[model samples]
Target: MKTQNFKTITLLLVVFLTSTSMNLMAQDEQERPRRQGPDAKALADKRLKIPDLTDAQSEQIKKIRVKAQQQTLPIKNTMREKRARLTTLSTTEKANMNEINKVVEEIGDLQTQLMKHRETSRQEIRALLNDEQRVFFDSHMQRRHRGKHQKHRRG
Candidate 1:
């Protein structure tokens, strides 16, 4: 009877430890979905091919990206709403091409504005980069742009 009691207690303790560990791991995953380690900034800089990036340059690039996002967010939101509007207009019993066309034009214009802003931001970042860094940055950006824009179109 003592041996049986000992085995049962050991089994329960093992299960409790395993359950607690699993919960702790799950909680950690929920808290950190992205890189927040001390080396995260260093990794990002390396990925950008600017391993020797200065703090000032990093700050400047960050500002440019943030500013561009701020300026483009409204345009993007409007575009999304316009797209929904276009879908609604086109799905009617008597689809109004005229209204749909107007929404399309507005979306196009917003896209143009966004592209211009992005170009400006890119130019600013390029201006801050050295020749070698610029070469890598430009190529990287070109590849990114192609990947982003060509996702919907066949080669």
Candidate 2:
């Protein structure tokens, strides 16, 4: 049973990594947006407003977003399981600090992985953009940051 659980978790990690890598590879510098799934389409639409993306750049951003989603998969799964476990634990089970510590440690690891993967994906996307596109994207991104900061300041 223990071995089986380990295999299942490992398989999930493998799937997450493979899917992210494949999506990143699919990004070319000359593609346009299409309505694929609602979420993907919504993301593409949002990105379109920032700058006039050529088909390739749109695909590249889409790939980056997809990879970001993939990086969160394991963390999402683990959180769901932990929440369920916490909900079901009897008073006795809840009292075991060691068991709780183990779960907390796992959550911490997942959070670290999430940040690391996101940063790595951002670096990969940067590599995909040319000088002109990168400049445009960076400027737009700065504007977005400033806007968000303004919003926070106003509230």
- Best model per lDDT: 1
Residue 120 lDDT (model 2): 81
Task: Please list the residue runs of candidate 2 whose C-alpha ends up more than 4 Å from where it truly belongs after superposition.
Answer: 1-43, 87-94, 130-155
* Residue-wise C-alpha lDDT for candidate 2, range 22-134, written one tens digit per residue: 88767742365565666876765676464555677667777888878987897788877876665555256347777767776776777788778877876776677778767
lDDT of 1 at 98: 85
Q: Candidate 1 on 22-101: residue-level lDDT in tens? A: 99999998976456778887666666776467889999998898999999999899989999998899989998888888
TM-score of each model, paired residue for residue:
0.71, 0.50
Q: Single out the weakest 10-residue window by summed lDDT for candidate 1.
A: 42-51
Give the clash count for each candidate: 0, 5
lDDT of each: 0.88, 0.74
